[model samples]
Target chain A: MDKKKDILSLDEFSVEQINEFLIQTESFAEILKRDIKKVPALRGKTIINLFFEPSTRTKVSFEIAAKRLSADLINFNTSSSSLRKGESEIDTIKTINSMENDLIIIRHSDSGYINYFAKNVPVPVVNAGDGKHEHPTQALLDLYTIYKNFTNLKDLKIAIIGDILNSRVARSDIKLFNKMGMDVKVVAPSMLMPEDFSSFKTKFANNIDEVISDADVLYMLRMQFERQERKFYPSIKEYNKFLSLDMARFNLMKKDAILMHPGPVNRGIEISGEVMDIETLNKDKIKINAQISNGVAVRMALLYYALS
Target chain B: MREKATVLNSDDIERIIKRISHEIIERNKGSENIIFIGIQKRGVPLAKRIKENIESLYSSEIKLGKLDISFYRDDINEKIKSDVNITEIPFEIKGKDIILVDDVLFTGRTIRAAMDAIMDFGRPKSIQLVVLIDRGHRELPIRADYVGKNLPTSLNEFVEVKLNETDNEDKVSICWI
Candidate 1:
């Protein structure tokens, strides 16, 4: 409803515009619950998923989201794409642009390559992930998950734990949660902390114990080992001692507090296997699975916002 | 928007609703298998009033539901003017006869979208439409089984249906937009 052309970043939208996407998400979420889980909203439209990086959940989520809306989608195979044959990135995109797709969703290892694609392409571009710059859709789905649990996001304390420096999810979540009036605090090892920490508006803590008791939402960012160029921590054993969510940390959390992760989770690094198992055994606290399911609905809302 | 004329005042709307209620009951032969589903916003109150009228006068109860057809709309390219409303179909509609209610019938696109939305839930035995007003500029081939008033107008004139539940007054007016 805000008439935004692209969804590259959450910073380009106002709070009301972001809330509008959430409101539309409510309608789309209901559609997924029905017996027939498809709509004709994006009928006959073509969507392209161009991922320059390897991903599992985000790629499949966007694919399912597009199909559920009755849109034709094609995933560009980076391994066999023209870029490997020494074609320029812009020229390769220009060749694809000649096909006249309705939208393009991209993920690249380069920090700001999505901006270049969005600038060069005529169609709307959605940033699935761009290095450590941002992953806006992941943040939106995370917001939707939190919104489903809590009545109001304002003043709700969210402690984002794990790798903050190399996590695009952490960067996007901090910006969005602060915009939604939530109290955000990043808890990570000093080595995992961002170099330009002063640029972030959220509070910083070196350990999770500082905010584990008070936070309404404990967001565990995935430790992006692939993104880190060098060793940020000494060992997983030492990392687990400082920041891993074991049973003791789980017990300290509030009764209604939700645990989240922009997933592909490290089983024994960010959270212990016992704690992860409690997610199914307990009262629906671990929102990792919900985050994945809501990922489809939230992406549906974003796709609708971009194309419609 | 400038008001052109008041088509139906408070009392006229009440009398029309009463007549339409009788018509719906007589046509269906009984209210035994009827479930009233209203389009969100103004249609919801009209459906509730008709359901209540049938309940009290005929001494039979009927279930009511609300539907929002925003997602099913065909006009995704164009901007939708209204805000999205909640769609609540609590009971099973598979074998029940559905009486779809709305405030006005103009382009018939809303009813088309609403029908597509209802089919997604389950197949009803039958779906009969009931509208308070028929403005008569149909792009789609849709018609209501029960009608309150048939006020024909030009394309420029907009039919405004106000109900006490949502708008604090029951009045039907035509305006130039």
Candidate 2:
């Protein structure tokens, strides 16, 4: 497929485009330092945030970014909308498009819902998060955060752990990390591993010992108990047996391995309470909170490039 | 390759300033709080000359400032080898009838970026652009409010403006290179 025409997936964006986007993002970074943080770049432009699932960070970050660019924002919650009354996904998006929105930022519960919506929507569609599919912006922000810290992406060994099967973040990060020529390893319980994961061409590890050893970055995804209809493991104790990132495991990992988690973290379930309490893990290396702010910068760059 | 030069001299510059000053006074109705902000390098000298002419004619001083729009420039990183002169603005420009003076108005990106930079100082009461030469073919939606000469040119051609105070000569030329 022609690269520019392949907007259905975020994987189509080349490394050059990502680099250019980062450089473009630096132009707007000065806006954050100002007292009245706003730019008139997208003035009078309308942006629709259509989130089918509940998200505080992604939704609010996008809203703030749109507002900062002076774009008119309309937020739609699927639970409260006609979607709850069984309105088809296409019908909902078409209805929103009819309002003459310049762009649509969507997060849905079903995987590939964003791809489906992007195919249907006339306006530029930004994938916020789609089921267990992909969250491109989050991954972009993740990359941006990493780039800000390290000033490089090539040759970095990043280990993505936890519920890989249900993580849209992991899916997007895996693609982006690989595309940027970084070495990636997915460490997760075998039950939570995707079947076609090898297509990503990254290493898979069932043991955390092998995965975390000499790793540059450790990206931990939250285990979604809500996604599994039946309990995947017998008990929280059983789940922790395979999944928990305890102090011992954390100590075994490389000293420079930056621990990260996309939050609403189950403190003791996936990562131990003591691990979360570690000053270096929580304060220094772990910059998941800072990632929320970087989302605006990345999204601003994306919107500017795709629209302007 | 011959070292060719076309002479405009100081007299030509004096004539342009005289014409521009008359136009400014006529439109502004007495230069009250009217300020001239030059877009670095050549524009600053041109602005200073215009301010001098306005002061001599009307017996009143027009507030003059200089703006170095390098930091606000979009092409700074892309065209890394390009030379950018020193920028200096002497006074606050808030709530003044600001006139951005540039030697030549071409693609308009410079003006657009300059306007973006100008907002950082403080909000101006009104901004009116005055250019020494308005060579058409604007990539951006920008226009000079007061133009000395409107020279229609193609995209490939270059418009050069030289001021005696800065360039050791005074001239406006269109070079086909």
Candidate 3:
């Protein structure tokens, strides 16, 4: 196995590396299905989750992944940490580094912060989410989820809908999908798109209607309501009309097409509330639950990959 | 790696497997309460062959499974030469006697990890090991119950077991890197 120091971004990974992680992820996923859902792979190793921003799924997912592998984990949140005491970021990290954790998982509000922090740290650093930079793990889990639905990812048409500009998930997903030979199409209103969208190497679309009939995967990205400084769209109704995956749009998608979201999904914004309901989510096409569950599996694969 | 010597040919491997299968059945009395588990890669084929041999000889059905010890390995990232294979042990092993199969047993770390991986599924009444090649250099206090050829080799030498199922040939050789 090639030694990967840190999982900072999907752009840094080759398609082969990504494919290896996805394959190893299936082995981990099998562990989750067993009665004893724990392994002693990383026994006695310590991992620390250092988050400067708020998160629910990503934080818990890492914690679960570490624990399932029988590794000690410490979660450090910004609200309770020494960051409030005017401690410098370097000092805080250096102080944590002194404890000699095997790996450091960080989620910072600033874009590209993890790259600099990873450079300073001796141990491997996994970027949980770094502003608008990247969420590589999310992309990995999404890829695994998609791979589960559609065996081969090569040449698969994946239409990523919503918040392309400020979405770190979108940035990571596009890079990963493109690397894996997927035909990626980003669908969002012009206001929510990045000016340098052409550099993303994905087909740009102003509406979801263009790809709804043919796309193999409908990846709905959560709108970064908090990240926006100004109004990107007119209103929720207007956003729903153009971007939201309503029943009409959902029915138009191919019978085998899968619906994906890097969750905490905005029900009415990116997808209709009915489509995301428990009954609808139970269907094979909707994979939100699988994504969340696969998140733990994928992270376990990654944690094992980095620290092993 | 350079091949040092051809320790066992295809016919030699076949004869050893037959002898081991007879030993396994004779020791266990019958295949009634026995289950065979193959450690991933080469072990799966060996286990299947043993199970088939016993079935054909005694006309009894024996449960077989494939175990991948990658996750249970102490050296997680180290020595992972191939991708993680699927571990499919469908049936229960709560009190059944398990015959753990492997192509070669060297430092005994792989067997140790295999044992740990098996325990995760269920507890067995007794776990006996079957190895085609037992290269002498025991890192842990582990031993195979049934052995094919006990070829003693130095630490620098490697024992390579090739099964017809995986390598398109049945042969065992000692190699030097």
Candidate 4:
């Protein structure tokens, strides 16, 4: 019998398990402050970072997390792998699985590929990201960043603004944050948010200013024009006019509210350049860099939990 | 359930703490250059108790810290989530006489890991071990410098130390099946 679980979906975890992971991640964060950051937690273990999709932030942070834990890593990306030579995704995955890999951190463009791999593969699998379905690790890192500021998540309000249609980060965040008892609001064009809402409760709005005043956290998603298989809006200019968080919208939100973006943010399309350019004053309002640091810690915790 | 018996109560625990505090001071010649770092969980309270005893007698604040050695463990079942505690060493450990405290000294693997973790901060002048219970074993060639009590037992037996700060009571017990 398989004794442990593969972290394929964030929604599969109970509230206690998620909280425990956060607590474990906090300990790793403390380790990052030491002069020597490496620890022997996952020594003698091998990891294969299988990324079928393009990613810099999540992939790089996972590499750093694995290396910091003293685990051996092999970066199996799409461009370098034999998949470029017309090999099937299954054959590619099975080829990697044939090796002595203890864990596989996979990022694929197709939704639910991780779930398929988790069933067929013998060793544990972590969903770094799987298409537009879920990006569990990114959501975890975002939660860790938000948790550092507000201890009481029960009463917090989060407004996720931008291209909700193409954002896997937004989907994962909405479900995970909702499960943790936070109120989530999605601000985007009507065509972006689906009618069913996938059984996850969230308030939807097309106007950014309507959701700004009550938000404790203004989470901005990138306007992924590259992922636009078909045009959701008339143009980028029209989308910016309706929902972009420019200077005027930034000032309208609560002054105490912090801004969060799962990186490669479409600078002027989703949020104003001024908002991202703002210098850190207090820790509560500090953004971006803090998220990156927390990303490494959260990933370390996830790897440690999945393998050891 | 398993067979268990308490060997040390609250008052006995207090007296042992005081004696260990005095032993630490006398061996180092003074508390000025001394730094106390406890292995997390039960060790934290014992370290704090000794620091208090030194402060009361010498009327000076001493450096006390805590170390979590979860990441350094060699034998752990990865199926379960490992319990991680905080390691807060505020001051630098360079050139300081460090006393590593723990509740029980069994196979000495924990002390070895704690020492390795502490060395990452800086090179200390020397490292000493203080344990409340010195259970006999031969897994590693290590020994405690100052011990509260020496209890020998069979391989099946295990020592359990409960501190008021963490466990809501002060006592030591031995458990065996």
Q: Using TM-score as the measure, which candidate wins?
A: 4
lDDT of 4 at B176: 85
Candidates' chain A TM-scores: 0.97, 0.90, 0.96, 0.95
The window of 10 residues in a row where model 1 chain B has the poorest summed lDDT is B77-86
* Chain B TM-scores across candidates: 0.97, 0.88, 0.96, 0.94
Model 4: residues with Cα > 4 Å off, grouped in runs? A280-283, B76-81
* TM-score, one value per model: 0.96, 0.70, 0.95, 0.96
Assess the local accuracy of residue A281 in candidate 4 as a C-alpha lDDT between 0 and 100. Answer: 51
DockQ of each: 0.52, 0.08, 0.55, 0.62
- Per-residue lDDT of A124 in model 2: 75
Candidate with best lDDT? 1
lDDT agreement of model 3 with the native: 0.89
Q: Which of 1 and 4 is the better model by DockQ? A: 4
What is the Cα-based lDDT of residue B28 in candidate 4? 98
Give a tens-digit lDDT track for model 3, residues A103-163: 9999999998999999888888999999998999998999999999888899999999999
Q: How well does candidate 1 score on lDDT at residue A263?
A: 82
Q: Model 1 over residues A1-308: C-alpha lDDT tens digits? A: 35448889999999998887787788778778877899787888899999999999999999999999899999998989888989998789879889979899999999999998898888899999999899999999999999999978899999999999898999999999999999999898888888897788778898888988999999987888887889999999988887889999999999999898888889999999999887777746888899999999999888877876
> What's the C-alpha lDDT at position A51 in model 4?
87
Point out the worst 10-residue segment of candidate 2 chain B by lDDT: B76-85
Contacts from the true interface found in each model, as a fraction, amount to 0.42, 0.00, 0.53, 0.58
- The per-residue C-alpha lDDT of model 4 at residue A116 equals 88
Clashes of each: 0, 0, 0, 0
